[model samples]
Target: MKHYYFFLVFLLFTSCQHFEKQVPSEKELLQKELKAINWKEVDEYPSFKDCDKLGNKTQRQQCFFEYLAQLIQEKLSIDTLSILYPELDTIEVKVTIFPNAKMKFEPQFPKDSVAYDTIKIDSILNARLVDFPKVNPAIKRGIPVKTQFILPVIIKVE
Candidate 1:
């Protein structure tokens, strides 16, 4: 009877360990979801024009960041608002935009597993100039007529 009990206890312990190991970590799940994104379906947003006129690299960067951020929020709200987990209440997604390219979301995860689950952007949003000055041979442009950008999307999970 004693040996049988000991064997049963060992089996239970081993089974629990296996179950725990089988649960995918938040990072792994997020990465998998991101990888599954179809980049071709993502919509492109208008690019920042006359960035050189901002006069400060830091300010320009911040402006571009904010612009991209808004775009991400709008797109997510329109396209993915319903599909998100109920725990996620609001998402503050950040995005970087680049000239002649797409907006991107950088990977970020909580160091502590308990903090929160991070969902990286599944797809990249392409950017294009909607309105901007035309480069002329006679005029020297102080403001950057064009620039590459990076965007981050922060999703608010409930």
Candidate 2:
């Protein structure tokens, strides 16, 4: 009976030891999760009301970009940018969309290029680019995030 009791106790002790695992700390778990996430790509791109219904990620992104470009082109068409800078064919505009759905547009000019007045273009863009439709911010891990991209807008003179 004594030997049997000792064997049972020994088995219990060994089994408990095998089950004991060192649980990682909260900070360590968070670090591991962050490392696993891809920082370069967003799970969902910033979208408009018309763009949100698209099933594919790439198609949704493309629709959003094209819609934005068309809006910009339409707004700037009435402005005097084309008349002032007829030689300038296209302008690169840096667009930033905030999580709060606010948008900012800034014109990107080449450093060495002095053909057009930068201040005039900046003011025109700031004044013209307003009252845009509601934009849903980008999503990453179910959280809204700010996104920025440069878009080339063509200045067509009729």
Candidate 3:
């Protein structure tokens, strides 16, 4: 009975260690997915600066809107003002996109004043690599074969 007990304990210990080891197929799949993603070619835009020179608050606000429109066109290849806010006679928008991880857009407002008349826009966008095959030899231990990513975008109207 003593010998049998020792053999059972040894078997259990070895099995636990085996479970802890990473499956070779999973590692390979992750490596391949990481390689397929292209990170160097994304577009970026410069910051808006014209608003600082304007004397009037309303003019400064208009300058902000115009700057945002130009940035969106040059950076994201999207004309947000023409497509989204054509009817508004005067408005301002600001958007920031983080490194495929997060993005935000907000209107520039005065330090001491509230923007009661301006329109606020906020949104979040997310994307991920998916649809990995279950039977691929590169996918070990039933691991999924995709990488996840996130991005954020914001727009403001005045």
**Tens digit of per-residue lDDT, candidate 3, span 1-158:** 99999999999988897678665798899999888765433222221255556666567655645554554434432334434544433333344433332334454434653433344222211111112112111112233222222222233342
Residue 10's lDDT in candidate 1? 94
For residue 145, give model 1's deviation from the true position in Å: 16
lDDT of model 1 at position 14: 87
Number of the predicted model whose lDDT against the real structure is largest: 2
What overall lDDT goes with each candidate model? 0.46, 0.93, 0.40
| Model 2: ten consecutive residues of lowest lDDT | 112-121
If ranked by TM-score, best first, what sequence of candidates would result?
Answer: 2, 1, 3
The TM-scores of all predictions, comma-separated, are 0.35, 0.93, 0.23
Better of 2 and 3 by lDDT: 2
Which segments of candidate 3 are over 4 A away from where they belong? 1-48, 78-103, 106-158
Compose the digit string of candidate 1's lDDT tens values, residues 13-115: 8888666656799999999987886543322223367443676656765665576565555555555433544554443333333443443444443466343
Candidate 3, residue 57: Cα displacement in angstroms equals 0.7
Better of 2 and 3 by TM-score: 2
